[model samples]
Target: TKETKLIDFNQCQQSSIENFIVNGNFPYESLEKFLVCFPKLCSLSINRLVRLNYLTEKDFNPIELKNLKSISFELHSIYFELLKALFKNFFKYIEILTISIYNDNGSNFFDGEQWEDLISTSIPKLRIFDFQHHYSGPMDHFLYACHSGDFRSEF
Candidate 1:
């Protein structure tokens, strides 16, 4: 499967690419273009998607890749509203989501309540939500909420 690797997507228009990963810095334009071209993509990983600018309404207007079920990405900071907008735009059918927050601003940005609310409202079909970070404190709180039926009680 080494030959099937898709590193540069500039000239790619493979509709049959079910699994895709962006190995390096990829512009939003290219990301949008590839997503539009790959209509049948079920799993997508944008590990190094460059954050040139904050995503706006115009950027979230794409209607392609409705079949995307699993997505993996890394976010530098907590931008819940931006994230909510992005999720609302294209992730309706997403079942599995893996996000690694590398740069959390501070303690104020680590609100577990907001995350739980976002999950319950935005991605209802989400079966597997994987969150990874260096800090284990927030994870403990999140896990405790889940195990104590606090998360379920909200639903």
Candidate 2:
């Protein structure tokens, strides 16, 4: 795990690091810290993030990542709105995006059509999208909606 320590975020400012991955449960504020440190990051993958329960729409900031190409993250529950709002301002150049929402219920937390529209309009260069459910239950309607919305074909 020490090899994953690409930068000493607390000690020095790393503005040149291009790819970063946080594979453990880190606070959402750490992400904000990293964005301030790594302005040229092209890829980011956070396996799990903690302390996001208190997040609100106003908590988001417009940090443009014009060179961002890939992103992957897994969250405990539904936070599609948070993700959308983040991406709307940040990840305009994203090409590959992977999102896994754990503890997903059968109910939809986000509209597939809106996601499709976001992909079409916000991330026009998106080439690969992988969305997964990490819950233990019967297959949810969200899976069906992804297919019905023609999202699966884009990958």
Candidate of highest TM-score? 2
Per-residue alpha-carbon lDDT of model 1 for 19-77, expressed as tens digits? 88877555443455567678888998877543445454335574645679999977544
Q: What TM-score, over all chains together, does every model reach?
A: 0.66, 0.72
For each candidate in the order shown, give its overall lDDT on alpha carbons. 0.63, 0.68
Q: In terms of lDDT, which candidate is strongest?
A: 2
lDDT of 2 by residue, 1-155 (tens): 42222233676566798998976865554565568788899999988754444544336567878888999888654366656666777787899999877654313544667777788878989989887765564565456455445433332
- In terms of TM-score, how similar is model 2 to the real structure? 0.72
Clash statistics: count for each candidate: 0, 0
lDDT of 1 at 111: 62
lDDT of 1: 0.63
